[model samples]
Target: MPNSSPPVTTEAAPSEQPVIRWTEAGEERSALWRSERGAPPPKRVVLADDTTTADTAYRQACEGTALLWRGDFHNARQLLQALARRADNVPARKRKKAAQVVPVADAFHQHRLAQSQRARMLGMLLIPFNADYSIPLRRAPDVKTACTEAWGPADAAAGASVASLRELLGITSAHEWRRKGVEIAALGEPPHNRIHPHYGVFSPVRGEYIQLVATAHLPKPPPGQTSLMAFDVGTGTGVLSAVLARRGVRQIVATDQDPRALACARENLAQLGVADQVQVVQADLFPEGQASLVVCNPPWLPARPSSPIERAVYDEGGRMLQGFLKGLTAHLAPKGEGWLILSNLAEHLGLRSRAELLEAFERNGLRVISRIDAKPQHPKASDASDPLADARSREVTSLWRLAAIQ
Candidate 1:
């Protein structure tokens, strides 16, 4: 097995105190014990091996402790899994059952309750970091850049703490994504072929919207006229813009407000060789000029985002959707079309209605030209045991092609 021991460093010993040293499985570790007035002596101990479960470590941590592992790195991973399973097995408060029956609303509430409990349980795992973004323990690699990307670069002598095993996993996944980009096949053939998505930018996991944009019928240009221009609002990873550019659009404007998303989009567009064709700008939705085509694939759910990553999944107050519907007409060229790709999961959840959506478009001076629908093919669609399987089975993603009411 390869050595996974993290790089180590020595610190200055505390004055006026004797540092206590101990040996565990051939490895030496040291810590300073201090007595404050009538306080008990600090319980300084170390882990026997990497097989130590996080739950055990967590219990020790609550008692003011630390762990020094001696086993293989892979065994530590198994221990973490065991800790996770234990955490998940913990039961939550039972809900009151109605005398008559459970309604659809009750089912939704129950689902949300279970989700909240799961989040709370998984959030107990805490990870520590040093001022310079280093984990101060054995076998810990330098995570400076990863921490910087997620939490910004640390100030001089400043350190922060983060909890939640879910978030830690997210950061770890983000690090891997930053190192190895997500592959995007939305971009078509020839000049524009590939898009490498960065960490913060939303990955193109749902292929339905991209397929709609790629296969949609485009209008022909008149004689002596150049190719049409299209705008990809919220061009996360610049995937949509690259797809448009590959679809024979003469010029493309990709707009986004998030700095991270903008940077991610720029890199992806550049790598896909569509940077010249697609001009990425930091705008909330539309730029100054009008385009023959406009595309938007906003968050499908009308729910609150608990964290930054959830922003890609939840749209608060439907701001992005409303903004696109309201400002789209002013930025669309004559005879232009606006493609709105959205999922109807919110409808099944009783959050929004189809009538309300149609009314919103009518009030915004836009009318639906046509719609293309696709059924979700994700594994969750077939997972009958999933809590949201009932809703997922009825979910459908639609590409609502719209045009300004003449």
Candidate 2:
């Protein structure tokens, strides 16, 4: 069942009572309302009951009003469902009449805009949480661990209050994922070595990219040499690092800026028994020094992240990609290779171009040694209901092997 608890209001009393009113039957029920001293009374309020649709509650929330749900716990969930349907039902804007279809750039922008709007609308539904991480309203189960995992413990002085329903749902989902763990076979081993990703850490749901890393031909052994060190940059959950370690790399340096990702990678690597072979480090992109092989699986999309959590999926303004390209040469041992695992989904969406990537490589004095591509097998690739299915259906993930031009 959907969680449908309204956010708890924390209005404080002001110097005097402010107006408290509700409109019904073309009449207003007025009462004096006071908040804590110097604090303001709630500007608006709405009643929540089993009969109230999530849409109605959301509408009130959008208007800066709160819904005090008096409905059954389960009924609130149904209302949330109604609200979601309404939010998703908006017709997409008609394309401008032109012989040429909308450019991928414009389509990408519009897609992001629509996504932002949908998120905004859905976020209006609020969920209240107590200091003990309990849902105070009836039928509210304990969500303390979930909330703590996401928000880093509750603030008691701040008092029990409400938060966006969307955020609450996300936290709850993260909790479940953390507990159960996502099974990833990309490491290509027995059950004991599987990767378990944490919340906010990008899961390698798309197997194509991981396959690219796992199958790409490693650089030839040095003259009379049999071993080389490899680095996996931004190694979320250490999937790529484990893949490299399994592929016979003598040593692997895996680095990431996110603490959660670093921790997740460490745990997964340890589980895989490759911790001794792979050294996990906290670095923005590349760790100090060069390596015989440097690989990075950066966020494929080049756009601003709407929230901090989206960083795993969105690379704002292509900063990470650009940083990788610009810094690859400095981190590559002479004759060594840099394997960039990327998706062409951004190009399909019109967010970036093939030429731009090629140009970046050239400008960095890096030449494509070889390119290997694989088609995405995710269900979304075949999901016709997805607004961008047409583009997704044609998406390809690739491993771009690069060598310094020098």
Candidate 3:
């Protein structure tokens, strides 16, 4: 983190959380006490060990307290799993709350606080592994299988590992996603119609943007140009590039800053038999030169991310969004169009406004030619229990067809 970087705002900001100091095994130990941010600070900090009962751990977590583990790593994971079970089974009396209406922005803020608190509690259970990802504690189940499954075989050379149980769960979930693969109807047919996302790359489970890219009209090639070419900015898994190639675009170039995303895109393009048509390049936002069409799907949230995985969802200060908008004209060919995929959730939450978005277009020498809209079909959209449901239910994703101002 640099001096200019914004302060960490999430519950996982270890620097902002409480600190714990205690004598462990006759040695003094000090560590940051992980607790949910935006909520009341933990009223209790107990040094929990392998001998701590799961019931006690669950009780403490439910009481808005924290447990700093100084025990075997494997037991910590089991304790976390137990805590999750207990958290899921909320008591009826405690579960009931009056449904009071809150302003959209306030509701969104509260929703984030609840989420941060939940993650903080879950993150308390930690895991420690040796250089080879081998557990050092006795009676620990062999995690080599799970580790290898999540991280590739190359991870065997990992020098040392210290991560939260929540993070481990993420890796495990990634392995399942990699195996099952997200189905993209716009990509083509059954068995071969999916993008296998790498561990850190953003998954393309939201199909609305892909559909927009697939069905939207493509700008005609310049009069003298021999064939069609398009650019896919921030291509995560090359799904958008593949969609363009499959739709008969002669050539496509996809750019991304992350090496993991570049590799994932390359593999997917090759698997889809469009490797020759789509070139994957490593670049911050845009590649060199220009094309007939440009597509960008930036992170929706304009906030600081707590971890690497969250980077795909959070666009700090709307850097990517504003960057793509401002740079679209320079890289687009004559009469070219830029397809911007964005969600209105930010507007609903009062983080950004429609007037601001439109002003960005005007200031960037771009004007909306047309817009195609779609509602999200993900499970979260229909989750009534979600504190942000009001905004989610009304949120609409749009593919804004933009052209350089005359």
Q: Which structure among the candidates has the greatest lDDT?
A: 3
lDDT of each: 0.68, 0.73, 0.76
TM-score of each: 0.76, 0.83, 0.81
- Residue-wise lDDT of candidate 3 within 261-299, one digit each (tens)? 988899889988999999899998999998889999999
Candidate 1 C-alpha lDDT tens digits along 129-243? 5556666556655667866776666765433332233454566677777667655455655334545555566777777778778888875553456788888998887888878
Report the lDDT of model 3 for residue 352.
90
lDDT of 2 by residue, 89-180 (tens): 55555333322467767766777887776665555444555656677677776788887776566667545555555566677787787777
Model 2 ranges off by over 4 Å: 1-47, 61-71, 91-101, 154-158, 220-226
Worst 10 residues of 2 by lDDT: 32-41
Rank list by TM-score = 2, 3, 1
Residue pairs clashing in model 3 are 131-159
Question: On lDDT, who's better, 1 or 3?
Answer: 3
Q: Best to worst by lDDT, what's the order?
A: 3, 2, 1
